[model samples]
Target chain A: MTKQVVILGGGTGGTLGANRLRRELPDDVHLTVVDQDDSHVYQPGLLFVPFGLAHPEDIVRSRRRQLHSGIDYRQESIDHVDLETQTVHLADGSTLAYDLLIVATGAVLTPEETPGLDGPGWMEKVFTFYSPEGAAALEGALASFREGRLVVNVVDMPIKCPVAPLEFCFLADWYFRERKVRADIDLVYVTPLDGAFTKPVASQRLAGLLQEKDIELVTEFNTGEVDGEAGRLVGYDEREVPFDLGVVIPLHSGADYVGRSPGLGDDLNFVPVDEHTLQSKAAPNVFAIGDATNVPASKAGSVTHFEGEVLVENVKRFLAGEDLDASYDGHANCFIETGFHKALLIDFNYETEPLPGHFPASVGMPLLKESRMNHLGKLMFQWFYWHALLPGRDIPGIGADMPSAGKQTETAH
Target chain B: MPTRTIAGATVDVNDEGFFTEPEQWNEDIATELAAESGIDELTPDHWKVLEFMRSEYFEKGTGPTVRVLGKTSGVTVKELYQLFPKGPAKMAAKIAGIPKPRGCI
Candidate 1:
């Protein structure tokens, strides 16, 4: 009997998961990947687009090309999943049966969820760098600007790449400085969190960087409205941050298809999974990863990379009817780009916060400290992403475990 | 902050022995630092990477990406790891006496 594996969303998680499983399982176990479109984006590059550091054409590659030769790639919009029947229905009225399903549709940015955000001034005066179109538009908008209040706001939490809003402000400071108009600009960062970042240790360091860069930090701001025409962002509590140009990261939720599949997702449409095993709580045959699952980890590329390793191993074990490995510790790492030609790297997992340490060992890049080397590593990652990470190749020495060998545990407090 | 005796003078470094002040770098200090980082001595090949990284940092105010470093340094990425195990950018810069190079967490 031949078993079929159907994966949703040929983005980072789906593509890598398909390639990895293809290599693991026998040729008889057919693997198929479905996506809304063929374009697979190197999402981290979106941050550099608005800063003129990258081009949209350079970051996007065909998702079909990303998968391996043996894997079947379907270019179709997913209509819904019939959990009981173990099948997926496409918008074209076509259906496919599967013995196992992998959901990796990730999150969708809902700009319209915020009143007046998508109504007027969208892709005009107000923008988001999360998408290529938004980033390219912002590049032009930022070019003509000499001086004014430029505010970067987050509508809510659990947005993909949580550190990106902070990165945007840092890059903006550099952008204006290069134009030699930094001193004339009033920069502000508005977030729902009470500090600069989610984690306490990193937030203190990031808050200091925001302060040093002369960017005002607005915290606990539950945005109620984006009065783009009036150039003001109103929080639910009635506090407002005025802006001439606003780059907003809108409210993010899981894919719309999740809504069509009952018992598969929560109110926000994220599949509830065992944060460690990635097994959907609602169904044992279904698994979720990346932004598709409501995992208490930062929704970033690195999290996908770490989870991919564990998910692959556990998927193999699940098929063999063996006890699963409950060992995924939520390991995630990210490069925080600070202005002035420097960046910072932080590696932590579910249990530990971002600690100051030399990652991998005492030989790697410094932790929780800004440096030009970290900036180079950030640029180099785009290359690593396409050539290494997406290929499901194991990164040497780096693993899912949060190492304490070279870490200075003092800062973790 | 931890202090180490390099070039017969006490210098400040983080817990991992990365120099806090790049300006205090000297040849004698680099040799000692290299030895501590597991290199017996700065080979002519090692100097090839270190020198290029130095000029790039001094010119651009930051080190070039490792991909650029591999393309320009005559030393390949594989050789870079052999020379500086684990991480080439920060390890080489720390030993080369330049400001800490940053990227990918």
Candidate 2:
């Protein structure tokens, strides 16, 4: 009997998971990857689009091309999953019954959830760089603007690539400086978090960078309304931050199909999975990874990449009727792109916050310190992401667990 | 971690005064914590939000964000701001004896 394995959402997690499973699982196991569209976007590249650093066509490829030869790639909208029957129903009136289900449907931006956000000034003055179209549109908006306050507002938490907004601010400062209009523009970063970021040590360091770049940091701002026509972001607490142009990361939630499937997701439609195992709490046979899960990890590609190793291993264990591996330590590493050809790299997990030192080893990339080498690493990652990461090939030294070799534990305090 | 005496009971708290151990929390502690945030009194409406936060924190190991609470906690976002004042998620979680609602990143 062939074991049918259905991987939902052919984005970063699904593509990697399907490819890895094909290599690991025997010929007896059949793999099917489902997604609404055929485009597999290099999401991290979207950040550079508005700055005119990268083009749209360069970052996108066919989803089917990324999968292994034997794997099935289905381009159809997901209607819902019948968890009881272990089946996925497609919008095209078809069903996929699976022995194991992997929910890799990542988060989606919900701009309409906030009042007046998708209204009047949308794409004209208020723009988002999360989507390729939005990023392309913002490029025009950003290129034209030479003065006035440019507000980069994160509507709420759990957004994909949480550091991207801050990176945008840094890049904007550099871009405007290149144009010699940086001194004329007021840069403000509005976020719902109490600081510049979630983790303390990193937040302090990032807050310092923002200060050095003259970007105003507005903390604890839960956006209630975006009066785009009026050029104002009204907070739930009635605090208003006026802006001439707004770069907003709208509220994010999991895939819609997860919500339609009963008991599979949370209030935000993110699948509730065991933090360690990536096994869905709703059912033993169902698993999730990346931004789709309600796990307290950054909704970043790095986290998804780390999770793929553990997730594939667990799926194999589950199929063999063996104990699952709970070795996923929430390891996440990110390269923070600061302006002026310098970036900071930070590595941490569930138990420990990001600390300053070298990453992977003492001779590795410097952690939490700005360097030109880290910036180059960021630029080179687009190639690494498409060629290596999406194909499920391991990067040799990096693994599922965070390494503590060169991290300064004392400096974290 | 640090210890603070609130409402005549010694409880463990973090630097921001959020209860490190949620088991040490009680109604009296909640009352005193609420007062600290300038909510002179805890109304039935306030307790409604606080109770929801407590139950959610215990079940999920983290308090709900304001958006989640507003959508599912039987309280409107407008009412949440009215009840908890400046910051609904952080302020309510603090008074409700839970860790601060933090960004996942």
Candidate 3:
């Protein structure tokens, strides 16, 4: 009998896994993928949309077109997951069964989690770039603004690409400089953390960059509410930061269906998986990759790509009745766009902090240091993302293991 | 691999990803790093400590001093020494792949 494999969510992880598995599996195994819509937005590109560097049409493509021919693609909202039966229930009152399951249903931004955030000034003076619609709307708001307080607030931790908010501040500075109206605008970054990032060395570097750019950093400011009408963000301790324009990265949660499934996820609806194997703690046959897993790593596309390789290998190992290789390190690499034709690259895993040196080696791209080469690499990644990355092809030199080439190994005393 | 010098230290770039050999580290590595970079025998909370260290570096561009790492991780300076005998500067270089960070020694 042909094994039935059903994958959920047609985003980066799902799409790539579907295509690769379709090619890898014999004719006996059937592959099927389900997602709510056919549109697959280049999510990373959303950061550039608000700055008018890209058109909305350029960022979105049909998910169906991206998949290989033999795979079955379905368009419908996921209603619930029946773990006991190994089935997926659709919102349209239909169901499908799978011998093996992959949950790639990444995260959703919950603006409603905050009071007054989605209120009167939503998309007027306040906005978010997490969604395509939000990015388009923010473009207009940024274009018409002449001056005043512009605050970018991160409501909480575990948000997508934790450094993106800082990148936005850097790009905004460059954007205003280009328009010759930088001095007229005030930029401030507010986060719940005690520093600019989760890592200390990177945080110190980024904090200096923030200061150099004239952007204020408000640390440990847990958001209590967003008073959109008053153009202010109120902290849990009652400290208020007034703004003429606010861009908020709202609280993030996993797919709605995660909450419906018994013992599948946490309070945030993120699937609880063994931080190592990417295997769901609730079920042995089910696995998760990308933003969907409550893995203690940045929820970025690069992380998803890295996890997909490990998950796919383990899935194959599981089917063959062999010991699954519990070898997925929380490996993540991201290009931080610092604007003015400069960027920084950081490569890290769950245990190791992002170190400085050349990536892949000591002679290659500089790590934890800003350079124009990194900026170009960031721009060029869009092509690689669509062509090589999502197709589940091995990225030649970039493997699951973090390399130690470019680093200087000396014990500090 | 191309070599470049930034801030007076040499950095090697390996596009083909053959920078470090995994077998060098002992199989029985530290629990947290064993799963990722495979460094062993780490007793202190390196993740919590290094994450704070990276966050601070992101903001300021330099590794925090031993006193700062101690203050941030909520461990005493002596406690930090117990984890990283070489201190913050040496530990950071090993993790970040940079030359032993300057200015500390």
Alpha-carbon shift of residue A175 in model 3 (angstroms): 0.5
Error of 1 at A101 (Å): 0.4
Quote fnat for model 2. Answer: 0.84
lDDT of 2 at A82: 92
Q: By DockQ, is 1 or 3 better?
A: 3
Name the candidate that leads on DockQ. Answer: 2
User: Which candidate achieves the best TM-score against the true structure?
Assistant: 2
Stretches of candidate 2 off by over 4 Å are: B102-104
Which sequence of candidate numbers ranks them by DockQ, best first?
Answer: 2, 3, 1
Instruction: Compose the digit string of candidate 2's lDDT tens values, residues B24-77.
Output: 999998988888889999999999999999999988888988899988999999
- List, residue by residue over A1-413, the lDDT tens digit for candidate 2: 89999999999999999999999999999999999999989999999999999999999999999998999989999999999999999999999999999999899999999999999999998999999999999999999999999999999888999899999999999999999999899999998887999998999999999999999999988899999999999998899999999999999999898889999999999999998999999999999989999888899999999999999999999999999999888889999999899999989999999999998999999999999999999998888888889899998788879999988998833
DockQ of each: 0.01, 0.73, 0.02
Most lDDT-accurate candidate: 2
Model 3 lDDT per residue over A190-260, tens place = 98777988876677878988998899999977676899888999865568999999999998889999889
List runs of model 3 lying over 4 Å from the truth: A408-413, B1-105
